[model samples]
Target: MTEVELTMSQRLRCLVIGIPQATFPEGLLRPDEAASIPYAQLAEHLPLPDTLELVVAPLFCDDFDALEIIETLGSAGYRRVLRIVAPKLPNRQIVLRELRSHAVRQGITLEMVEEG
Candidate 1:
């Protein structure tokens, strides 16, 4: 019998959004409607990666939450590039800088890919 080859699915890339839930209107929004809102907000946070396998969805609670995720991955010996998909937030730059610095400190050659 001939052997068959199996391949794993492509790893999903993260898509972090910066919009907070507080910005949502007071009226009720359907699930689809809420999803569309974040896509529109992406324009404000341009320069995102052209292709994304997976999206972080909605928005990060705060910078700390984002950083913690990255740090945890780093500590786990995940050396591949880590993508942080987030919208344009006030502390976006600061967060990126800190992440880069943390990667350096970890000595893991962890590159951060951003997709807003």
Candidate 2:
């Protein structure tokens, strides 16, 4: 994925991303609308804690790589991260467990999005 610096003035600098065939709804801050990303290319643009927030569309649902992303973010000193996922995904539990484990390994806590 191609990444650029976003200068939004917020405590949390979030990056919103959508997977292939997954639609990113309105209200997302897209730094580059014309860039396409490969699953493995995200390493280059991993968000730093100094930025405050990052949003990304995962290539695979509930995969280890996704957990790695969270771990990476956590290692960067990010205290919080919001992972937006499809409500209808089949592997939600797997992802959740993996995230939990990753959190445990990293000595940080993970929070899930609240449902209305």
Candidate 1 weakest lDDT stretch, 10 residues: 1-10
lDDT of 2: 0.49
Give model 2's TM-score versus the native structure. Answer: 0.48
lDDT of 2 by residue, 1-116 (tens): 22443222233355543354534446664433323344454455544335544455452354335566566656756665545443445776776776677766765555444222
Writing each residue's lDDT as its tens digit, candidate 1 over 1-116 gives: 00110011122133334434423244643222222123334443333332322233322453345455455444544454544555556786776687668766654343334433
Q: Record all residue pairs in model 1 with backbone atoms less than 3 Å apart, i.e. clashing.
A: 15-56, 16-85, 16-86, 18-87
How many steric clashes does model 2 contain? 4
Pairs in steric clash, model 2 = 13-52, 13-53, 15-54, 15-55
lDDT of each model, Cα atoms only? 0.41, 0.49
Model 1 off-target regions past 4 Å?
1-59, 62-64, 108-116
TM-score of predicted model 1? 0.38
